[model samples]
Target: MKARIYVTLKEGVLDPAGKAVVGGVHALGYSEVSEVRIGKFFEMELKDSSDGERIREMCGQLLANPVIEDFRIELGNS
Candidate 1:
């Protein structure tokens, strides 16, 4: 199975990198870019494990930090 994990900062968190990207976009004349948020994408391949709960636990424990960010995992047959 293949899992795609998206990690992103929660609301109210100040993202300097996102701000920098926004500033650069504006400098390049993309004034229409009002907001930008940066996030991470992780693609993982795992063995065939029927335990869905364990997979979720893996996401919470190793794949994502629960304090400042949130993660969504999409699992599919590879």
Candidate 2:
């Protein structure tokens, strides 16, 4: 089985990287942009059955910062 994880900053958290990307996009003459929120993406192969609890534990433990980040998991067939 395959699994994917997405980590992103919480709603109230500040994202400097996202802001920088927005500026860069507008500088290149694409001024129609509105906003961007930067986040993390991960692809992994899992040997066990797709378990939500275990996956959530992994996210909380190391995949994301619980203090300021949120995560979502996507599971797929191998």
Candidate 3:
């Protein structure tokens, strides 16, 4: 099984990288792109597909910063 995790900043958190990207887009004349946010994506191969708790634990423990970030997990066949 493949477990994919998406890590993103929580609401109300400061995102300098996101701001820089948005500014750069505007500078490049893409004014239509008014907002930009950055995040992380992780993929892991698991021996047991049913062991979802392990994946969740990994995300909570290391994959994402709990204080300022949130993560979503998706499971599927590799």
Candidate 4:
């Protein structure tokens, strides 16, 4: 089984890296690009018995910052 985690900044949080990327894109003549936000992606191989609750615990405890970040989990047999 596989677990996928996506961690992203909450709305209204400052993202300097994302902002820098936006500026870089516009400097490359892609002025149409307006915004860019950065996030984290994690892929883990878990035992078949691993449950969503356990995966969520990992996110809440270490994988994501509960104060400024939100996470989503996806589980699959692949």
* Candidate 4 local lDDT, 1-78, one digit each (tens): 999999999999999999999999999999998999999999999999988897899889999999999999999987
Report backbone clashes per prediction.
0, 0, 0, 0
Q: For model 2, what is the error of residue 16's alpha carbon versus the real structure, in angstroms, after optimal superposition?
A: 0.7
TM-score of 3: 0.92
Ranking by TM-score: 4, 3, 2, 1
TM-score of each: 0.89, 0.90, 0.92, 0.96
Model 2 spans with C-alpha error above 4 angstroms: 48-50
Off by more than 4 A, model 1: none
- lDDT string for model 1 (1-78, tens) is 888889999899899999999999999999999889999999888887756677778888987789988988788986
lDDT scores for all predictions?
0.87, 0.89, 0.90, 0.94
> Candidate 2 on 30-62: residue-level lDDT in tens?
899889999999998887766867877988999
Candidate 4 runs further than 4 Å off: none
Lowest lDDT sum, 10 consecutive residues, model 1, at 47-56
Q: Which ten residues in a row have the lowest lDDT in candidate 2?
A: 47-56
In terms of lDDT, model 2 sits at: 0.89
Predicted candidate 3 versus true structure: per-residue lDDT over 1-78, tens digit per residue = 889999999999988999999999999999999777799999888887368987799789998999999999999996
**Shift in Å, residue 46, candidate 2:** 0.9
Clashes of 1: 0
